[model samples]
Target chain A: MRKINSRQAGKKVPDYLENNIVRFVYLLRSEGVRIGNSEVIDALQALQYVSLENREKVKTALKATLVKKAADAVIFERCFSFFFTPPETRERLRELRQQKIARHEHQIKEAEQVFTFRGEKMNLSALDKTVYAYMPETEKKRLRDFLEMNESRETLQQWYRPFLETLVKGRLRFWHKQLHKEIQEVIAQRDTGDEELNAIRDAAAGSGYGGRTILTEDMQHITRKELPQAAALIRRMARLLATRISRRYRYSKKRRLPDLRATLRASVQFGGVPFKLKYKSCRIKKPRLLLLCDVSGSMIRYSSFVLQFIYSLNAVVQRIESFVFAENLERVTPYFQQGQDFERTMTAVVRESGQWGGGTSLHSALKALMMRYGDELTGNTTVIIVSDTRTIHHREAALELEKLREKVKEIIWLNTLPRQEWSSYTTVAAFQRSAAMFPCNTLADLEQVLSRKFLSA
Target chain B: MFVSLEKLQKGFTSAGYICDEEVILTVYLALRLEKPLLIEGPPGVGKTEMGKALARIFHTELIRLQCYEGLDENKALYEWNYQKQLLQIQAGRVEGRYGRVDGDLFSREYLLERPLLKAIQADRKVVLLVDEVDKSDSEFEAFLFEVLSDFQVSIPELGTIRARHIPIVVLTSNSERELSDGLKRRCVFLYLDFPGIEREIEIIKARVPQAGERLTAEIARAVHHIRQNQEIRKKPSIAETLDWARTLVSLNMDRLQGSTIERTLNILLKSRGDQRVFREQIGADALEKKIRSSLV
Candidate 1:
């Protein structure tokens, strides 16, 4: 057998080391890795089994005891390395912090110089920044704190959009609009020092200084890099949809009569007449979702977000079969099952399907899709088509869609086009006649549309 | 009981099990604190083997409970012997002695003990391995709280039967579904990934002793490389590495080469798809070259 390969091999651990381990466990917990008191006790006892000098052994031991899930192992490993940084690295980190402080002080001095410049023309007091500067720093800080408060409040309103208007105990929309108007007027009127301030604002926006940034009305404005957040929001919305739909369906229908076998078994003492009736609770057969996503050039921007949404929904409800189409269709149901990262899964999907780069041919795509996977759809299936419906020069595949609608419970089309522009797109109007069309131009649209159509019904 | 974790590690090593610090530490803590150790890993990573090894170290009987879908408390815990109860009831009625014995029939004499109950009621401490617990439903997972947390089982008829000896519980899961937070909160969670190359070599030499050192190293290295290839479905595990080494020794190969690997590829790769993927992607020559480079 190999002997313990560390300088402190067979050495007893001191009491302070256990305290350090406990603190490390709490650090892991604060980083959103779930760890319990049992794990802390285990870690303290487990340190006896391994040499502290042996970094790899200590890491593996802590990981085994602390991390429960594979996804959490990533977080654990990252925090582990940071927590156990080497002595030299600690010194280097101190030096880096000093340098960062110096740089921050220099940048602040430059910012103060620019702001203090009294521009002779174009009165700058109308601007929000000049007005904020006149107030105490505490007042400005409160404004920032209030903005932080509104961010979470805005997220809550995103979930309950319809009810937010009536519940007006704490509404800050008027104040937000006033500040935004002042900022806009400042930008509109050019002053002597305004260029430097505008440059500073551009830099802040580029680096994402959250406190100073103005909130846009469109809550669904997500960049390509924000796919992960968008995906999480979609998952939350999917769960909300599932619960709402199930609860509504459960209450709307009548329960079946008391189960005879159960009643007889329970009523054996009472000569078969049931004393406490066991009603046959209706088992809600979850509707199977079959998604047909358009992946042409026009719909490529919205397709990924839609696919992530569908994938998260599939996670909650397992009865979803997804297919992607451009000129032809390919079943992407198996890709989501792999549980790989969204980017990697999408890359694989793109590589496998020949029609990923082709034009949108709705007639041919739907015909081929029905020819292949039409048998998979039952009366309990909900066929969801996620596309802009901008088919180029092809006739509205109404016959195939009508046939599909006949086979499934309902055919719902998620149009990526804006509501005003939907009239300009002739193909979408034609398809809307065959199926129910809902505008899904953004992430918020998806939540509203899903709630209005499925849950409300 | 073992004096320390080092002693436990030594005992396992002497028993022909190559355990890393993680396994040794977790086993030690579980024994010391009397908490159930929840071990999760990909299949065939010696999760079940670790439980058995710990049992040997403790010198206790290993009671295994394999979990599957729809597994309930009836199968896991004690169940009543309905036939005996019914017969006794019939005899009581014949003798006209059944005035109001409402709860007398539901006694310990009519209880049929399963693995879980047997472990709890064992005379001495035993190793209770709840293997592949993720296969069981969430309701059954919640049902385990009474036994897992307090070392007692509640029967509506008998109130609660506490454990005679708190068995060293070892729960393993392949993470088929998310386990209940209540269950996780009670146990010390441990995740065992695949062993490193050197550790795997030690395991191979211990299990397949006839295989020479050179052949053992080569086989371990090949298995390590195969596992890194994400394209191959069903990566070759440590057990498969041992089997491949044994296969090579049985064929009387003094050293490993491209041809030897090609002939015994079936032992390493389980599926035809995996075999084809290995042949087309990472061929025998590539594996041999890696082994040679590592040896140098």
Candidate 2:
């Protein structure tokens, strides 16, 4: 790295500090923190105000200029320690990267080797070649012996090609399992003296799913220890949602029709000249949210997160109604409205309601909701149903959902199942007919769904 | 002007603001770079207090704009004194100077300067604190971009008005909303979390000197413990901590006993829900025991 030195506060600053700061900003951007050129420049300019002798001052100065959000601060801390602490660590990390690249290149070369059968080169698929290259020496010898024995069989000649392909595919699956296990073991053994550097490298390499940021991790796979971080991220997303909704309402409130009567009434003080115009100031109705969360065995994990999100939005939305259902629907809006802590409230709802960890009956749940809260459904209401779409009596449930859809402005189905698995579930197809379905198995998906559905409206 | 970072830290300390190195460094850079400092954190983390402290340290005026829903440019930037203009027009008709009043209607004489305009048009450097800026509409936030970037505002009648002496700008938010990327990019960002245990004790001692040293330490530890509880929705703020300390001093309590804590817990935990959680989950006796154990 080229070094540039500058004078600030009558002190000579180190040349490498600027170069390191620029690299650190890029590191932050790669870790999903947004930074622009101006911020980079600001970070550079901030260096002039602090003495480089003090490490904490330098870190703080860079942080003030480069980081904008609180959630990104944790990533910044990790990256800062990894990049700036113990100058030799950076060199060590560079060496590790080089070694990793060399290893990958060697593996690719080995995978390019062709298989031979009876002095003739056999054309193999890419999967077979990869599996052959990475497989253990013993497994390779076993495969060779098996193939050699089968090569001279005249009775099985007609069915040879299909059989060979199936055998290679089975080996490919086993190879994948082996590779995954090795990677997990490598991650588990933190041999690196610098744990922060190892963690950053692991996350960058995408080896350990647990090493990934909480925002991008799947909700169901989030461990108990990571729940607090996940909950904080959810709360931040909810806060952003509330702000967008309030801003939209405030903007629309300003564009109302002019109130000529009020204008005249005000002009009476000014000789009836109608000097100023008055707006009608009609009350803008906040969008009503009705959340129906399925607490069945399959969807219990996602429902708790969704309920926590709704609980965070309790103060912002005036007419939010929450319902959790398994075999039957139970209204839990009162629990949220009580202003108690979410943990206690969630515990009470789970214990008192008869819908905890049971089979899903969407038809009965929707029927019970309509019969009890039919008057609350209106054009302003948005019905959000969080579920896996796996329920008994799918046909009746679809019909009831369509009926509920007709009474509300829109029905948004947050399917807990991944998008690739949606096709395998017939219930997903049926539910898709009456509601706009979005796969929301992760916090990122939930944020995107909420922003697209609610903010756009 | 502060020639060194140590001087700035001392200035802030003298101003009665207990800030860490991060705060001092960020504020120093903001001052040197002439960039707006956007401070965001949870409620009552001294985001607004930092701005006030800056103004006090500099011996300048602190012009505040308390942002809320539907805040507009006219209210924040500047507004025309319409009634004065109308009176002028009526007087001009009587005096046969209608054309003169028409020219004077949009002049500086009738222009009412709000916080933004006042900060720009001040004869000396001032501190501008836009408090709870996240509460304002996005349009208002967008409107701020122009004034903040160039330190100037354009009025149709008076044309562009630039700053006489560029005032130091500090914007505070409670993280109620995410600010625009454009706005965030234009300023330096700082996040103020709750003070740590030692810092809280120092703050209590500074703000409420009547309280005994033992009492202050116990109060700080108890408050820290409560803040660590995830169940409490609204954590006790520094101001609340000081208030609790003062209450302890006035009540002549030297140490935090279980009964005294039970009686005075409401001072720190404002909401009934927070109070109930503190009682049921982390009871007064448990907290007292923890505090006493820490002391030993």
Candidate 3:
């Protein structure tokens, strides 16, 4: 007759939303809206920092970063205070939810008009800036021709850069980032005063500018702030692959690919048992990977990025020896056998990792690891290091790295910095003396190192 | 097929099954169509015994494949007779025909067939019970799909043997992890539930012939009343209802009284917590009135 209030009238609810903070964060995982600890903590921290006066804004703002996608954000908000239910209550809740959905459908129509107006302004902005981002301007001919087919304020603005647009909310940030290099190039062109414009004219052979910027946006060398390029960047890495293919093809005495002569010769012994001759050795060689990450405060941003990179690369690598280092180093190799949860795995990583935000001195850590695992790294091994070379004890640790580098076949260091930031206390720079190349400090550097330095090598 | 749902309606009325027609037909068609029927629902519903009863009505051989973790083909399918093969080799060498005779015993003919192959090759119609499949691994689930989809076996030495007729395949799952789409698409899905009080009264009277009509009805009413609660660990299945009815008959009781439920607690609930929870729900007075009302 009455609905059982298991959550208890929520006297603690606004307080739960307000005080008893349990923020439910859902990661826009591969399957669906998967709640992860990063989203949960972001929602929790957003509650603490943001005032309750703007509840809807705080929810939207928190969910924008915490939830991975717009669709997931809607689910995370609903589950944030979702109480347990008995079987009897499900039908009633189903009916009420359907009714609410019908009402929201109407609200969406009205919200859509406002949404569309904002969309038209964004289209005008994109068409004003990049000619390609705009609809083809048979526009003055038809009303629909002026706007994109999927034009809604949310869809149109973010459609320009789907990877980044979906990450933020009602406001478009990283907007300045899109036009950053372009503005700088335009300013440089103005100083050169029509010389660069002549290059565009020359490139176009005196026709109207086809309107691509003279500075080609080479996606092959895009930096790490764009996480979406991680896939494309990894594919361009040829040397890493050449090394893998070479090592994989290299045969052991015990293992060999099917020799046609060997199989045919053996077939005659069985008096032409052609059925037995069908079995043959195959070519399959996957490499074992060993990864060392620095999770000290300086490398926190790059640590997550690199771990995710290594994890995504698991389809190629046979084994990844994953380790996280701060003041001390610890192995989390087995934990990543199943793919990473990114934030949750990193949090478990940071919690048990023993030395997070502690001090760092690679000499003691690497020497300890060298004594522990010197034999593990042989001629076949490839060592990938993800860290900022700002070691706590710079000079001594640089010497330790030199000693460790002798044992491994190759060391690839991914440093998170612009080229301009690399001039200062460079432990990674010093560590590079024994490595294949000086540290790649930016995502651009990572891509360049992958393409030119490693792959092409 | 399973009475075609339209035909199942008349069959249910005649059989006094008093439940949803579609659900019964799905169970029926899964048998008739020769596809594994995966029946999922809350316990105390007759999910397990339905296969047993269907085997009875159809006069077919029922081969049960009980599943558990780490159950490999060696245990589930057929393992070679290592000792017998060794003895055959010794005996064949004495006769100087080692190669020719030992090979025949190792062929598909001499192989020990477990439930999976037994169900396929039965002389009569077979009802294969792949019970508790969720406890098995994903690899096993995939392996099962290959065999179940095609009722055939291929020995490396001998070629494949297809089933002479499509046998009845019934697969039951408790819904631990979502089954692969490959497996679900190969079968009919049916969700069975515990019967309501009125239907359960009729089931007790039908299955438990020894119990008096008044006593069976009282036991059925008490069982339904207990099933309504959510907190009980294991619901009293239809088999349990029959067990409870037979217990009263052995006690020489003409009617189910307050003391009878307490004495025969095991017949109603298999688990300890379910018995305790049921006792707490229907206190002293209701158990007394159970017999008093059924007398009418």
**Which residue pairs come into collision in candidate 1?**
none
Angstrom error of the Cα, residue B4, model 3: value is 7.7
- TM-score per model over all chains: 0.63, 0.82, 0.42
TM-score of 2: 0.82
Error of 1 at B236 (Å): 1.3
Whichever of 2 and 3 has more lDDT, that candidate is 2
User: lDDT by residue for model 3 over A287-339, one digit each (tens)?
Assistant: 44567777777665555456556554543455557676778777777665655
**Candidate 2: how close is chain B to the reference, as a TM-score?**
0.98
Off by over 4 Å in 2: A1-21, A85-88, A102-217, A221-240, A250-272, A275-277, A310-316, A326-348, A351-354, A360-378, A389-413, A418-457, B1-3
Better of 1 and 3 by TM-score: 1
Give the least accurate 10-residue stretch of model 2 chain A, judged by summed lDDT.
A1-10
lDDT of 2 by residue, A378-402 (tens): 9877788888999999999999999
Winner on lDDT (1 vs 3): 1
Docking quality (DockQ) for each candidate: 0.31, 0.56, 0.02
TM-score of 3: 0.42
Give one digit per residue, the lDDT tens place, for model 1 in B207-270. 9989988888888888999897755657787788888888899999877889888988999888
Best by lDDT: 2
User: What is candidate 1's TM-score against the reference?
Assistant: 0.63
Which scores greater on DockQ, model 1 or model 2?
2
Kindly report which residue stretches of model 1 are placed more than 4 angstroms away from their true locations once superposed. Answer: A1-23, A37-65, A84-95, A105-289, A298-320, A326-355, A358-457
